[model samples]
Target: MPRQAKSAAAEVRSLREEIERHNYLYYVLDRPEIPDSEYDAKMRRLQKLEAAHPQLADPASPTQRVGAAPREGFGKVLHSVPMLSLDNAMSREETAEFEARIRRFLNHTGPIAYVAEHKLDGVAVELVYEKGLFVQGSTRGDGTTGEDVTANLRTIRSVPLRLRAARSRGLPERLEIRGEVILSKRGFAQVNAQQVERGEPEFMNPRNATGGSLRQLDSRVTASRPIEMFCHSSASLEGLHVSTHWEFLDLCRGLGLRTDRANRRCASLDEVFAYYEATEAKREELPHEIDGVVVKVDSLELQRRLGERDRSPRWAIAWKFKPRQAATRVLDIWPSVGRTGVITPIAALEPRNIGGVTVSNASLHNMDEVERKDIRIGDEVLVERAGDVIPYVLRSFPEKRTGKERKFHMPSACPRCGGRVRREPGEVYYRCLNVACPTKLEGGIKHFAGKHAMDIDGLGDKLVHQLVETGLVKDLAGLYHLELDALVDLERMGEKSARNLLARIERSKQTTLDRLLNGLSIRHVGEATAKALADHFGDIEKVLAAEPDDLLEIRDVGPEVARAIAEFFAEPRNRQQVRRLLDAGVRPAWQPRRGGKLAGKRFLFTGGLAAMSRHEAQARVERLGGAVATSVSKNVDFVVAGEEAGSKLKKARDLGIEMLSEQRFLDLVGDA
Candidate 1:
């Protein structure tokens, strides 16, 4: 073997050894001997060397660790152990009934103890360990199945790569713990604020951000994300001596796991409610977002006797906090134009805290919301975020008016660009006429580089902001025009990173029509709309020339949407932008024609489906060329009812719309 080959092999081995050492110290012990930058530099060098000499790279290379990889989509990995959801009880009466049911099942008339804890609003994941070392991890894809996220899971600092158990406690020979991976509300705000400053689209909530981050195929990107986790229960434990759930948690704590300190042992239902109420009040004050509290039977013996329902555990119940509504004065109402040109209203409020987080602003949705609520600039209004995140002003408090409040109206022009803003007929939002407003430009460029859009591998928000602020990128077309040297000159954009980014930028020109359409930031053209458009028009050129009548004829394309598409194409600037995007070689991936299986078949869903959630079911139906209506109309074909079939069931029967049970609905698609 050549001397250089041997030297390169040794270098790769040493880098792996160092990275593993740091991983153990940082991920397992929460201690690091080197700064993050230094560690990253070392990892980068290893990556470059490995890329040059593939034989020298290890499969377990630290460089291989991000959460995404241009996924066609995620596949379900059936869990060896089921991930059961908890039943919920909102009031003391229901809480008492939960306890009584457990007692009845156990046949114990004497007494029982319970454990209460805050239920973190986050994504559920399972960590698998073998012989004291972390081996694999996956998302709770569908309770019984999950997507492999081992690389991304390895990036969370609190998740230990190894477990230690004292022989006395009977540590399992092999172990798997199911838990929630949550982002701190503070962290979410900080990250999104940075993105906002860079003219990038911000996440609506922390859970959405956490979910998107965890699904990234590249571990390096996932590593940079500040994700935290809390273990709730053990899914499977082998060769372990734990006899109860409480004991199991204690053992987890002893192993240096990051468990909640507020988890308490309760003596009665009264005490449980007290804990729940206390947490409910302090929940907003915590650094993280929590929707509610979970109470579980403490004794393992009783839990075993109580067993579980088909979907939820009988041993535990979540007490969800009602949406916290508070009265506040709306000081002003203003519209912020996004990169996509969609104008949205932001309500400036007198400072107040809802669920512990300070509230100064809330989304007014659109012009209709403002008129419906009769919200004036100085009106005292009720705001809420209890079950739904993002505080919303509910209604006006007329009693507090004192004739001092003033009526408010949305602006007829873009505030930033001084351009005309028009609200499409029958649509909720008004849109900015200016295509090059600084914020819009920044947002569009950011979208063009996002994971779901252009997938430009190395262009983060910070870099994109620098480019725009430095006047390097005037529009979306500037991305394609960037030279490697120009990128390399920028801070943080090294030679390799610049080259990789440029390559991705070049490759992105060949992106699908759906991705490009979604990236353009068009009003009402979300991922679904983009997909439909791509399917209707095979390429960007055809889409640009499509007439309103032509578009309205397409499946899922309504008259209003078709008009929006036509209006967008009617603008000369919008046409010029399209030309630039094409000149820059950005290709769009367009899906081929999909048969409309449920065409002319209107569907309504109430409650939840056994095979999928209501939202999931709706999305699946639309994907297969179907329409979901809020109400059962004369044109409706099927109403899929779940376990708790609501008012929609009766209404469906009254309207004579065909109805399907959960099983029947599943069978229609062969999903049962």
Candidate 2:
């Protein structure tokens, strides 16, 4: 079956923006609009889809950073080390998988020790002490640079101004301590009572109140807030004698800094899971909020061996507990149309607080889901932030429902354009069939101009929407007809911007056949399938003329995908649009994958290459039927090393994997 993620490049971009917006809301503003589980779902989905199609990965993606940029009122402080986030494991199965992945990456057969600490649901801040005196502190803003909240952090009495004298372990020349600043349950209640007395809006939760209080411009106001800090992990130790995370925590305690007493050392994966269950069972009894337990490889050497991804560390993971549920009355049920014309049912609920955040809506997904759960308007439904990320209607209580409750029926027409809607055979989704539906049309344009498709640089969502609403362009081919005079007059488009957009549109005419196919908005034809089609057929005309059976002959093309392709080209309207594009001089260059020596091999590169860049290496590999992977695994056939190869080189060597020098790698590709 084809993955639900379509036009990998476009969805990748869309998911990135959505995840980043949530990050800003949760991290910077401290106004968490979604549960942590909900946020994790988006991040995990983005990671999976991006991994499948590595070409769509972006450096600015939420998957590439730990947090959002610092709230802009204060000065910025750069950290000596990047504070990467820990990936989450929702169940023991996922936690076990985390360990299994590490074993494969490290090629280890021995037992791995770990440090399990209570994953604090509080604001994470970094404090630096120079020569035993507190020097500076900041929030973990964007991981590298953070807002300078040194004064406000100082106001918290628990944050030591000077390190306490110790015999065994003296203070390092400089120490960077990472900790969680949390407001106590009692403190939160008292603060809310004060807010009520002062006629001010009370905070939503302890975590929010803690973050908002810490970021206050006035240190005196922050000092008044009853908040404390619990030292957790740190990126830098400076001159400390710590070989393991366990030792580091003990050392931190000895230096008069408070650490979570709930921290446990686990010798194996089973032990980690045991602690996790125990911590979760008694989490409510704790003074502050703790959503999960963080498990990290105890051996610093093992951690070094595991390394990290661009966004999070590989040797550690946050094992989050189950989602929190709340009962809320469904006031209304409505259908919302997506860019792809799929209409999803959403339930507007009487707002209720679940896991410290207020949720007013939950997704019903489709009519099938609604029927399965028996959800209806006026029903008191059980809503859960599934994985703490999305508001989900778990089930509806028909027993508690009044006779006034109504069954929901999907509308015959689209809510956006009031156009005819239909459900295809054996599909769960209902789609708007009208090609000119504003929502669907704009979505198609977005996919067409996406980086994965025609690679039009200056065409953004606003510009695309403007182009559609102004009647400047109705279809993909109409984009080619846009003039600078009209474009310049659109809101926010200067003369320079108009010219740039026109140039980008002109440049898009010269894309590859595979990208052109992906941009066409065919039902299930995404980047991978499009590339396979282009590589197999070698021409746009061949693909257009191919039968469903012919499409099935290509690798990875299933019957459904092949049928979708055949059906797409069979449409007279689609054929005419292709003709219009051709007449507009849009020539998609075709290239066939060469069947050669490198055909079945997978190559991974480490260190620097003198002859060419890593990207050039990938292109050379892919030109043949070979593949390029980002990590060292049993799957990788060759490990190419150059000047100063890092841990991957060591890992590959330890696995007795074949290594090729820069010259040898070049010769292999050159010969092929």
Candidate 3:
């Protein structure tokens, strides 16, 4: 080998060791020595070196975290040992009963040491290693067999590809480490923001996001997400011995695997309860989502002696925190028409305080969800606030229900416009088919003049409602032909206000193609998707003429979204409305500027912009041929942070992505 090659190989080894030490400090010890930017710089240097000299790179290098190719699909892998579920203890009495039962089963009254660890709300998986090299990983499908997700697991940086050698003993010949894949609260928020930007359904919580990311057939997609793992237990192992559960966790940490540092070794059940109480008190502050604490027998001998049940182990019990639920009588079930015309069932409830918020209503999600939960009018139902924001009906108690409880049936006609409603094939939502429904029209017009859309200033919700209610504005085209005198006659509208509104509306007609597409209120086409469509097709006529397959060729346009766009354009009424709007001087011009200052860069803005509104900043970026992203990712070129910037700013700093203040951003865009 050349001298320079040898030098590069030595530096790579040194970098890997330093990086692993930092990972251990940050993940296992919960103590970081350096700033995230400094750490990221070291990582980038190692990655650049490894990329330049692949022959000198090691498989265990940190740069190889998300380097795997996409897999076709997950395969089935049988667990060597079964992964049993834990029995739950919902209350203090239940927990005491569980301890008494364990003592009775063991026929012993002696004090038993226990290990209490946070019960992470996430997807469980088993990672297998042979000769200290990571080999396979699988989900806990049915305890006996699981779907192999080795490629997806490899994408998580916290899961070391190679285990470190023990100081007193040789490397393990075989090991099966069990852990939970979690999306942190910050990561979940970031992912949901991306989902909303792409017009996809947002996941309910971090657990759902983790599960969905693990199940992706394409491993590359999983690689893009920030997933984490914490090894809690071992399914099987060889060439190692640990008499206690805490000792096993220590061993895991020594082996370059992440273990929760918050775990406590309790000498008695009282101590266990104390640990549980302490953990529950700090639950909301934890980065990852945890629902409860798991208490287990510390001694391996005692655990084996207690033995396992058919579904759960006798040695372990999960003491769950009380779910944030409140009993409320359903006053009524009403259908709400969304901008996309989907009718959602909402339950008006007697106001109850849940998770510190007084919630008066809960979403039934759809008719299917309502039916599954058997929710009825006047029925006493338990409502839970998912992620402490959206309230949902958990279940209804039929035995406690009064005779006045009324069964809710899907309305045959739309409630707002009395139009026909139909459920599409393979869909759970019932949609109003009438395009002219007043509810949908009102929603569409509101969205069209929204800050993120065409951004017509002075167009408030009241004005839109009055225009729709009085039949003054039948469609978007009607806005272009509105007379100033008629607007001045409306409630709260004067001559100056009417003239300013007219000027805003006229100025909105000269928007770009992306804004125009967004203003059209097409189903599943959000601001990001609209920008992608406009960038790809460049002309409105081209986009209209494109087939579903052609639309699918663009990034972020899935089959459902492509079909929605095609079906929307295929409607005769929609086509006529578009033609009328075009004839009314709604010209969406496409001007491609090459090599502009911000061209081809992706920018993300968070917090409040003091100098300008977020919509104005986005428009400026778009005018410079740049794109705006909703989440922080490796692909983002810069984050334009403003006042009170939150998680996105932290994430950008962690990834070593550039950041700009409002003034700096304006200078870059030549607006300063």
Q: Give all candidates' CA lDDT scores.
A: 0.75, 0.79, 0.84
Model 1 alpha-carbon drift over 4 Å, by segment:
1-56, 59-62, 109-111, 130-136, 160-174, 194-200, 216-224, 253-257, 265-278, 326-334, 337-343, 347-361, 364-383, 386-390, 393-412, 420-672
> What lDDT score is found at residue 185 in candidate 1?
79
Clashing residue pairs for model 3: none
Could you give candidate 2's per-residue lDDT for residues 1-672 as a string of tens digits?
245445777788888767756643443334678898788778777876777777676544556432223344799999888888889999899999999999999999999999999888889899998887788899999998988988778766566666654456688888899999988877877665444323243465677678888888766567667888889887777777778999988887666677877888999989998898888777767877778889999999999888999779999999888769898899999997766787878999999988677999887877888898899889999887622235778888888976999999999999889999998887777889887798888888998888899988877888888998899998889999999999989999899989988998998998899899989988767777888877665567766666566667566676767887898899898998998888888998874454545654667799989988776687677767666657776556789998889999989888787999998888888844
Q: Write the per-residue lDDT of candidate 1 for residues 574-665, one digit (tens) a residue.
A: 78988988877666655443655653344778877787767557655665666566655554568988889888899889988888988878
Ten consecutive residues with minimal summed lDDT in candidate 2?
63-72
TM-score for candidate 2: 0.44
Candidate with top TM-score is 3
Distance from true location, Cα of 387 in model 2, Å: 4.8
Q: Model 2 residue 565 lDDT?
A: 84
lDDT of 2 at 232: 84
Weakest ten-residue segment in model 1 by summed lDDT: 193-202
Clashes of each: 26, 7, 0
lDDT of 3 by residue, 426-520 (tens): 77778898879988888888888888788887777789889988899999889999999899999999999999999999998898888889888
TM-score of 3: 0.65
